[model samples]
Target: MAVQDLLRQRFFPHMWCPGCGHGTVLNSLLRAVLELGLSKNEIVMTSGIGCSARISGYVDFHSLHTLHGRALAFATGVKLSKPELTLLVPMGDGDALAIGGNHFIHAARRNIDITAIVMNNRIYGMTGGQFSPLSGIGVKATTAPYSTIDNNFDVVELATAAGATFVARSTTYHARECTELIKKAILHKGFSVVEILSQCPTHFGRKNREGDAGQMLENYKKITAKRGSKALEENPGLIGRGIFVEKEKPEYCQEYEKTIALAMKGAGR
Candidate 1:
């Protein structure tokens, strides 16, 4: 199907800012869904409260624009009820890592069959310019005018250590990479996460003096090193981008079905 078939154009004038990179991420996701040959009925999209979370309202699929930091919980329920459906949850830095952190880790640990995409724009773009959990140390925000002292959480690392079977990273600058990685994540059996380094030109750009959205994307190209690259080996501080983890695991829904069968047999019914 054409990619335009997946959109709800009535929401055309989106809520995101003029230069926000979430648009690229959304485009990649829609393209990936199309490439996967998933019909709108077969795909379930969920999101929480954030600029990125606004995607749920735009996608012409079974969507749930849920509460703050609760998209995973809602998505999990949906998956348990209809294990055959493809579940996708897209969230922002604060929505996924701050209030939704507990759910994020627990879902990873459960290894449920859901693809969660994180838009890491550093600062909170939706609710004014505050430093998000993914914001770098010393980054300036409305809350941290001088500089932020909070250490940023590494989303890829967190997912890997939480038992996610699939994890990948891409930047808004790398549109092809984002689509390819998300395509892989969707096909994975267990829980999968793809973190996209999105740019917030209004908030992050102005705060860090990173010029315009174009400049921020250029910086992404300059800073991102491929996994196991010689450049990363030499610098040791560069953000490595690639599929960091992919492993076979029993999906949560399938295991739960097995448990139900076992209980029924034990009851002699």
Candidate 2:
């Protein structure tokens, strides 16, 4: 079914304010799900606290609105229990990187059967504009009235090093591109993480001179264009907006099946 038809329109009123990048990410997610032709009943959207968490409420699917910074853990449980449904987590930067940082790493290391889409606005938008772990060093934020002193985490690099089977990054302005990346992640066999660089115009933008949603959108275009061009020169096969990681690996579920089979054989079940 098309995503528009599957949308829970009743929740539209709760959508983020105009020019909010979360909306773009949300649209991309829905498009990806629809393109996969997966039934809404078979997909579960899990989320943590922050503006991004509200996504779970709007999607027409089995949804779990988890506590702050623990969406991945919750997603892991849901995936393990069902093992058949698609588990997708939509989390904000601080929610996934700060409070839930440990769980994120372990989940990646285990190659859990789930996909996480972190909306990296680079700041905490839900509760004032606090600098997030992904915030560029010396970048001005509400909490960092002067400049962000902490070094930011390159989320894709971190996830790849932690053992995520699929790790990629995209920004909100690349709507079609972001959607394509998300679809690839969803179809991946093991743990996948798509770091979405979003913009919180209400907080991050208003605080800085990023104008508003419109301005931030333009910035995304510029950045993506420059990066894409450079990548092409470095690696001709590097599509501007395509899967960066795609390799066959031992999925966690497949290994678990082997474990159960061996245990049952040993016990003569």
Candidate 3:
């Protein structure tokens, strides 16, 4: 359960930039996995192309570093083939909500048994400061010199509407809460989503004038509140945190097995 034991020593000195929240999130994740008493062999991590996605490479576990925005697709396939292995998918803001939008919704709709952790840094940190679907309206990006006018996604709401059985939200500033929520999501039966608002000091931070990672995290603490808390009621702009939804549902792979059973019985083979 020690954190160091979960790391791939040869790949030490991660590639994340200084002040990047990705490192913090990764540590929180390892903590959660360790606390859950899960062995590295029992978990399979998958990721799409982005800074956050790089986490899949650092962990000493079965992992798939898939193409951009296709992590869920690969994760789903892996789950179907090997239902016993726990699927842990980590994706970036744009990687999860923009290019992977289709896969995101479909995965939720199917109610597949996989735990997806989205490290939402607002802007596309890995590929320049491009506006991501989770980036707030009026934010500046390389693609939007003046400001990005597109409406941002409320990830928790989106996941709930898409039919994920369990949904939770937390910020990198709230590392303890984030790790706990991740643990809960992983243990949930059906599709689960845990959104972590990470700070990208390299791209989003510079573009938004959020100062360094420390300053950005301080802002996050001031702007976010637990779901249904008095702070949210007092401050309309405060983002809501905590689990939004948790419900039991028949999982996709289980349903597929039933269908296969019926087919075999009908064929009398």
Candidate 4:
């Protein structure tokens, strides 16, 4: 399928700021979908309120633009009702982990057949650059003019510990790697989480002096190493990119079917 066929062309001239990495993420995601040969009707994309959430509006899939921090919740219901459809929930860092933190963890715990994409730009981009939960200590933002004293959540660790059967991390700088990871995450049978460290050059970049979009992309290249690589072993601070977890597990919807069968037997139906 042509990538253009998967997009809602009427919504082009996307709203994301120039140099924002979210657009790159959108491109990678679409490419992954195309490579997987998924029809528009077979996929569902849900998103919450944020710059990243706007993605649902551009894709020609069954889309749901739900309340802030609730994309996963709505997606859970959709997957439960229609288990055959592929569920894709793309969310901002703050949208997924700040207000939506509870839902994020529980969704992983349930191991439902949903792919949760976290666009981790590390700031609340649409809300005037507030410091988000993923915004690490010493980062400046509108709400943290003196720099944030709070720590950031390690998304890969959080997702893995929360019981997501498939977990991975990548950055916009590594576009091909990001696309491959998304493809793997979507194909995984149980709950999957892929954290893509996107760049918000307008907000996060200016506030933290992270340089322009290109420079930030370069920084990502310098800071991240492929998982299990010798560079990562030598320099522990480098964020590792690649699938962190991929294992078979009891998927929620299939287990739910079993529960229903047991209930029917009990009722002599």
Candidate 5:
């Protein structure tokens, strides 16, 4: 647990640019929140406005730094005002799918328990490059300087069709399989989306020349080994990274605690 005492070194100089895969996704998300021992006041780390929302100002614990794409609506009001906080929502890709695409599809269709680490890096590296919504459908940024002819929003198939129980995709040159798919999307209960695939390499590596940072981690290790053997020969169809989705619904704080116990037992007093 000595990872510089779980970082927040007074926000020590991390604005994320040097061949930035958002600092290998903030060092595999502080080693998957210190290997899930949790507690640093139970973790919050929300974010928004670009450069991966400056990683909630270097993460000491209980961060916000909001309002670019509204960081899953301020991480759904800090997990519905502390429903046992562990809500780590790091964003990017134009602050989560182009101006927070309807708050990332209504916080994954209200399955919002929140793990959402989406450093997609497909352009728009802090308001200069532009063209995001995942940016791969042709690619050339600075408002698609002759390439991106639309069509590119596959953020784990739009967070498993916006009902996100758990969704995965990893990159940043596989930083330990993107920290074990963000440590199984923080012990999955409900809304969990990973979708990292980072590496801007200074505005998508000088517009696809893709040179330094070891040739963009050797073209992301040959595009994640040909997209991980075509997602194991397309088993269950088109699943790209590991753990494409895991189910078990009923989360948004256990269905908002059963609708506040049926509105306090129908106000019987």
Candidate 6:
């Protein structure tokens, strides 16, 4: 289907701030869905309260706009009840790694067949410029007037350690690559986590003096190297992008079915 067909056009004049990287992420996600030939009925998108969560409102797919940091929990229920449907849960840094953090780790640990998209813009854009879990130390936010002293969680590492079967990282600057990564994540049969380093020009940029959106995109290009590249080897400070992990594992829903069958047979039902 065409990308436009997947959109809820009446909701146009999107809510995201001008130059916000979340828009790019939405665009990339739409293209990925279209490229995968996924029908609206075949996919379900869930989101928690935040700027990133607004994506659910824009897409025409079956969607659940749930409470702060609970999108994954709601999605887990949906996937378990209806294993035939594809689940996509998109969340902001705070929405994904802060209040919703427990759900995020457990979901990954379960190896459920869900696509978790963490749009790490570093600040809580929807609720003022508050520093988030992914906002590394030294970054400025409204809650961190003197800069944050707290270290940030490396999303790729966190997801990997939590037992996600598919983990990848990309940035809004690498939009086409982000789309490709999302497509692959959707096709993976087990838990998949894709962290997109989205930029929040209004909150994160203004607070940190990170220049305008264009400059922020350029910064992403400068600061990130492809996975396994010599540049990454030479510059330890630079972040690496691209798929970090992909391997087979027993999916939660499928395993649950086996357990149910065993119970039924033992009961002689």
> Per-residue lDDT of 85-153 in model 5, one digit per residue for the tens?
888888887788778888888888988788988888788777778877677677787777888877888
Model 6, 151-204: lDDT tens per residue?
999999999999999999999999999999999999999999999999888989
Q: Please, what are the lDDT tens digits per residue for candidate 2 over residues 37-125?
A: 98988998889899999999999899999899889988988887789999999999999989999999999988987989989898888
Clash count (model 4, backbone only): 0
lDDT of 4 by residue, 88-192 (tens): 999999999999999999999999999999999999999899999999999999999999999999999999999999999999999999999999999999999
Task: lDDT for model 4, please.
Answer: 0.96
Candidate 6 versus the native: TM-score?
Answer: 0.98
Q: Which regions of candidate 3 fall more than 4 Å away from where they truly are?
A: 266-269
Ranking by TM-score: 4, 6, 1, 3, 2, 5
Looking at model 6, report the run of 10 residues with the lowest lDDT sum: 260-269
Indicate the worst ten consecutive residues by lDDT in candidate 2.
235-244
Report the poorest 10 consecutive residues by lDDT, candidate 5: 230-239
TM-score of each: 0.98, 0.92, 0.97, 0.98, 0.37, 0.98
lDDT of 1 at 185: 98
lDDT minimum window of 10 residues, candidate 3: 260-269
Greater-TM-score candidate between 2 and 5: 2
After TM-score superposition, the amount by which residue 153's alpha carbon in candidate 1 deviates from its true location, in angstroms, is 0.4
Off by over 4 Å in 5: 1-14, 23-77, 82-88, 91-112, 118-164, 172-189, 195-211, 221-223, 226-243, 246-248, 257-259, 266-268
- Off-target runs (Cα >4 Å) in candidate 4 are 266-269
Clashes of 1: 0
Q: Write the per-residue lDDT of candidate 3 for residues 1-269, one digit (tens) a residue.
A: 58989999798899999989989999999999999999889999999998889999999999999999999999999999999999999999889989999999999999999999989899888778889888878899999999988999989999999999999999999999989999999999889999999999888889889999999999999989998899999998888999999999999999999998888885854
Clashes of each: 0, 0, 0, 0, 0, 0
Clashing residue pairs in candidate 5 (N, C-alpha, C atoms within 3 angstroms)? none
RMSD of each: 1.0, 2.8, 1.1, 0.9, 16.3, 1.0
